[model samples]
Target: MTSPLSEPADDVIRAALKAHGGLDRWRNVAYVSADVAFDGVAWNTKTREHPLSHARVTVETGEQRTVLTPFLGADRRSSYSPGLAAVVLADGRVERARSQPRAAFVNDTGETAWDELKLAYFTGFAFWNYLNLPFLVARPGFAVEEVAPVKTSTGTWQRVSYSFPREIATHNRVQAMYFDEEGILQRLDYNSEIFGGQPTAHMLSGYETVDGIQFPTRREIVPRDQDGTPAAGPVLIGMTFTDIEVVNARA
Candidate 1:
């Protein structure tokens, strides 16, 4: 049967899915939990130059609930769902957090409780979406189109442009993903509307298989120059995930 996506787009998508384990196996996954180390300019921007921190992240894929616990200092946890978000403090106080997720990204005005909480929600939702790629692209409502191939230092990469529904958690509604010849995702390009339309080039590497799925353990995001080249500067956001556990609710 012909796919709903363009022929070239569908071919690349199928190749990517097969390389990362089939769609059927991914659909069977219920939840994923991981220990992650996060560091970068983005974190520093939020925490007044605080360095790398360990975090425990959990995502209920079926229900789209994401929770993140940062182990740098306070004993607190942040959780986000479709329209609601909350931060649980050490004393078991639940603070209602509000975020305009789709708003354009802006420079840090000043650190406030609500701003910190909103960052938590944004990071949690962003990582959850990042951890589940290609698979997430296969879901309905995403429009995929094949773009002209681009030659990088590595080789020619097949480019796929995506238009996501507003409800999907992502930096922007329109983004581009590049895949290697083996169908592994190499780079992602998007404008962070929230950060005032900052264009970024996010590179994914260090692939590891967990529960029949291939996931990139290391991610590095940097600002992109006008020509789409990575700008020379500290990484905007860098992260590595370990101790990943994908739980199958259907099992």
Candidate 2:
């Protein structure tokens, strides 16, 4: 299912895409929607509601767009882009919106309490970036370079350090992704600038296929030690995704 897009940066990148499904199948996908449940000390740190109940998320495939329904015990939802983050009403009215959303996090650390807008920005921005995954590398303006592989008790994982355009709202512009030998994504490393550069490791597992793509059903976000090991601390954010549906661009 090769599409018209040019080849990815290298064989490793291509292998990742093929493991997911393919760059071509990804090209025809418009969005991915799922039922998400979240828990962890993360909510307490941000001053948001702890133990978020299930929420429906729809994230765009080709760009940064994420919508979470019934945001925090309300009838309204939230919509997010790099430029704007909003609490939107059922009838298409915006209850509140913040432009240049990332700037609003200035001077904030993980210890700082957050308002709804900040919550929306961070949550939506993160999911948009996360959902895009290795596929994002296929697009322009991303610099991908193979890096030293990460080894663990189970096996060694091939890794790559990548940089994207400055405008993208991600955990960090420079980050690393580790893939299993089969080319499936396994772990991610980055420092969250909004939270005082908290070293983070996002480890993913329990893969299940949906609409020709592989998605991790379980996610663990935790603090990374100085040596790049997952610190023996809190599972900062534990997520489980279910009821996933991928919408095709052609549809």
Candidate 3:
């Protein structure tokens, strides 16, 4: 027997792509970069390479550091690498660590995922589709289901959710996605609770057309706390890309 979930969602997805960027534009590009800001504060910068899934993101405040050569495809090969470490709270003050020391993180949507840098890398690559451009070309890998009507300050949003399988080197992994009614990519809720007890939500806003591409100038991440409070408001940081250099002009 055939399942309705397994049926083609091409029309719905195609609507989203059109509202996002347009298939013709998306299919013509390779790599992209963006410049971001928040309330006049200079946040981090990001650049991504596609078809290869290699991402290089730099976070700067006083110290400027970068994550290089990260794998960003559906294979889930390399998440966070050795050099990709974190600083976490120890006793009262914060302590520097090589990686996430926790076992699992409880996200806003009630899902848990492994806490690691590799997961973060995969997240960046995943968001590149909606955040960087409205159009994306990739092998369809999941069943789409209309979830619910999601309303937000932006507008009334219709939503459809989808999921895919990921085989972590030693663990099993799965990713879920949510798209708006207009077919706009709205939110991605991941279950990797390795950072904290909260799910990490990578969201995009301030959509505007630039150079024929729909790009969001603002990127915000909200991570949940142990007791389930949305913790502090976003870090008031902004991201932007400039001087974008495409690796292969004609790939």
Error of 1 at 29 (Å): 0.5
lDDT of 3 by residue, 1-251 (tens): 11111224456666776776565555554445433222311122211112332334432111112222333333223323223344223232223233432222223222223234434443433333334322322223444566655566667665555544231111113333445655766655454433332355556565666556565555555654564233356642234434333322375
Candidate 2 lDDT at 247 equals 92
**Residue 161, model 3, lDDT:** 50
Per-candidate clash tally: 6, 0, 19
User: On TM-score, who's better, 1 or 3?
Assistant: 1
Quick one: best lDDT, which candidate? 2
**So what's the TM-score on candidate 1?**
0.86
TM-score of each: 0.86, 0.94, 0.50
In candidate 2, the residue pairs with backbone N, CA or C atoms under 3 Å apart (3 or more residues apart, or in different chains) clash, namely none
All predictions: root-mean-square deviation over Cα? 4.2, 2.6, 12.0
Best by TM-score: 2
Which residue runs of candidate 1 sit more than 4 Å off their true CA positions?
Answer: 1-9, 49-52, 70-74, 89-93, 99-114
Segments of candidate 3 deviating more than 4 angstroms: 1-10, 35-138, 165-182, 224-251
lDDT of each: 0.74, 0.84, 0.40
Q: On a 0 to 100 scale, what is the lDDT of residue 155 in model 2?
A: 86
lDDT, residue 193, candidate 3: 34
Local accuracy of candidate 2 as per-residue lDDT tens digits, 193-230: 88788898999999999989999999899999988898
